[model samples]
Target: MTPRARLGRLLNDALHRVMAEDDSVFVLGGDVADPQGGTFKITAGLAKAYPSRVFGTPVGGAAVLGVANGLALTGEKAIVEIPSGGSVAQSFDQILTMSSRLVSMYGRTLPIHLVVRCLVGSGQGDGAAHGRSPQRHFLGVPDLHLFELSPVHDPGEQLAAAIGLGRPSVFFEPRSLYGRYPLTPRAEPGVEVTGPFGGSRWMRLVVGAGAGGPSGVAAEVTVFCTGGTVARSVRAARALAATGVTVQLFVPSRLFPFDLEPVTGFVGPGSLVSVVDDGPGPAGWAGAVAAALATRLWGTLRKAPVLLASAASVVPAARELEDRVVISSTDIVRRLVRELETP
Candidate 1:
């Protein structure tokens, strides 16, 4: 099946699971009840399936989140899907103060399973607000879990895995990738799917052992990337391989609580590293990984790795402009060659 179809099926299964497991698990969003399905069609059939539990909330994001928080505290599970990044901005305060803070403050122990599914990245002319990677905003929040999903060929697996987690997760689906990539047969039902809120996964070295000269010949360069940027990094790796530069591309499936064990092991003394992100430079996961590497693994590195992120600016509305701001495969290939050639 197509990737979008797989994603839709996955989401549908997740919704059904949530409903069957907990009567309190309700869906609240801005015009998510019908037709448009909150822009991305993630919640397309939810309202029809559970009419009483599904609600079309007012445009006020803060109120919607606040209400969800209240319900969660009272032993309810809420899936709040915002229309776009722009709409979610209105709920920041509620997200930070109420939903995030409750777990630590009162030990409320309430599982506020927030599945914030929004379209991010470019190519839809969604404008600055709609086409933003706002996942950076919730990075530092103590009690919340942030996750960004870039399902290249399996939406059903992605959605099932994302929603199966019974905690607050910031699920960011790339707008540009929707309905584009196809789903592989690898995406099947009944597979265990992890929640995005849990933590980031380690980067597995994809390079073949013999291909890297000798078995023990460690990689001198490490490339860290996430989301669509991971695909770009893969392309860059292929290009670098053609030029006789053997580089390792580490793709983190999760964005928060940056997993260091696998990454640190791959990076050693004098290793050249670079991070590629699709969002603004400063607040993206790249910065977080860089800081961690500096503090925890600096002694092992030869030089400070460079961070290749989107230019510090709002996402552009036009397709061409958006493409420029966002990282592409060509951009990755270019950056890798330049960095390796310079020093």
Candidate 2:
């Protein structure tokens, strides 16, 4: 039997493996050392493994990022973790004007390898202040590789890819998906999936959301999503399938540097394309994707891509109120159904 582990555990193991293989790689974050590990325990045993390299910082995201910038400038790989989703904004300048721009500012002669890992999303009663999905803040930023981890994908591979970019990156870890794992053998059945991302970082799910392979259906609607909204989006796709709508659901691991080639081949004119995200529209990753699609498929797509995202309001702590702000599976189903049904 294949061993199974929670996504969080996989990420922890990945960090251990990464640090073991690369001596230059070290971690810095608040409460990320022994005992506490991290708010999510992603860096559980790093301090014990590499005492000199791993350091726990004060509860200041900006300070951690600033130090990481200095470390990267010295040609060392630094993984800075922002323990809370809402705290990520505190390091905005360090990420935008400093780490991401250092290489270009220095005449592109040197490369700064830094990874800013943020814990994003609501649902733990942490309230609007601590449960915001701030990926939108860094989306489309030049020289910054933006990635959102999916529970169904391999965390080790995703983390390795982000670190291997040889440039600055913002990796969003969805708090809601820490307990999920990849699909089982039964989920695959007879389905076969092939893609440019090696079929691991992304998936070609079938109806019912039991994905380990692709659905050989001529899709009239194509949905692209990532992060915490993946499972919900899949459920929405499954519901849409029940209504006889062919929905092609693609969950990509990387958000920025989004490869539209795979999308372009599957989606065409007269097809309804939708992007589901936890952030608000027109400024978030969904909006960025929609804009890219519109440009790439100029005059080719009949309808503008739809963005199914969170409401443009502070995420409320109340579960009911949070539902209103965060786009739900039912919301996806309803929105896609309406879009498809409309003349």
Candidate 3:
């Protein structure tokens, strides 16, 4: 049986493994090595084992990020953890202006091995101040490899994959599912997921026994999603199947350097494609995917691709209120059902 572990533990172990495997690898963050182990306890033990490497910095996210990039440029690998979603916004200058611009400055780089980890997403009832889902913001920055650890995906594997990029990389771990791992296998993930990333541009998966696999019919809708919403998205996809809206999930863990080839082939014009995300609706990640799909599959799609996302307004404080504001599994069902039933 596969061992069950919380995503937090998996990430912690992944970091430790990296640091151990490579002498140059280390961690940098605000109060990361303290007794509390940062906000989520994802860096709990490194401070004790590798005190020389695990750095606990002041509350300034930008300063530490700048320092991290500097170290990476000097042949040292650094894992800088952003304390909050808001903090990433604070450190954008260092992220975009420096870290992301390194390779492009000369059209090449010397392997500035920086693995930045940002914890994002909502639903902790942390209130509006701590309620921003800022994965969309990172997507705007170019030249940085971006990946998110989905709820059903292994944190260690995903983080390790990001670290493998050997360049500047930003990994978003949706806080809502940090400790949300189940003790047993619920079901096989509906898609072939790879990369920090889904390694291949894309691969095909037959969800309904293929066009003749078992159910003997092709999926009616192609669903795309990432991060904490993955498990919920899959559930909604399966639930829709019972109601005759067969669905398939296109989960590219990596966003930037995004390969739209697989998506283009599978989702043609008029094909039901729903891009679901926890990020804001307007000018966000989902919108980016939708726009790209709408263009690639133009003239053939029955209509424009659908974008399902959380409320465009501020994230609510209460869990119940938040659920209403955010896109839930049931919400996917309702949205896709309406679209699928149309015409």
Best by TM-score: 2
Instruction: Find the candidate with the highest lDDT and give its number.
Output: 2
> Could you tell which candidate, 2 or 3, scores higher by lDDT?
2
TM-score of each: 0.83, 0.92, 0.88
Ranked candidates (lDDT, high to low): 2, 3, 1
Query: For residues 130-191, could you state the per-residue lDDT of candidate 3 as single tens digits?
Result: 77778777776766888877654566766777776767888887887777662222445443
Cα displacement (Å) at residue 241, model 2: 1.2
Candidate 3: TM-score?
A: 0.88
Kindly list the per-residue Cα lDDT of model 1 for residues 120-186, writing each as its tens digit: 6765777787877777777877756666655432344444445555556676767655454432224
After TM-score superposition, the amount by which residue 93's alpha carbon in candidate 1 deviates from its true location, in angstroms, is 0.6
Please give the TM-score that candidate 1 achieves against the real structure.
0.83
| Residue pairs in collision within model 1 | 3-183, 6-156, 7-155, 7-156, 153-183, 269-300, 270-302
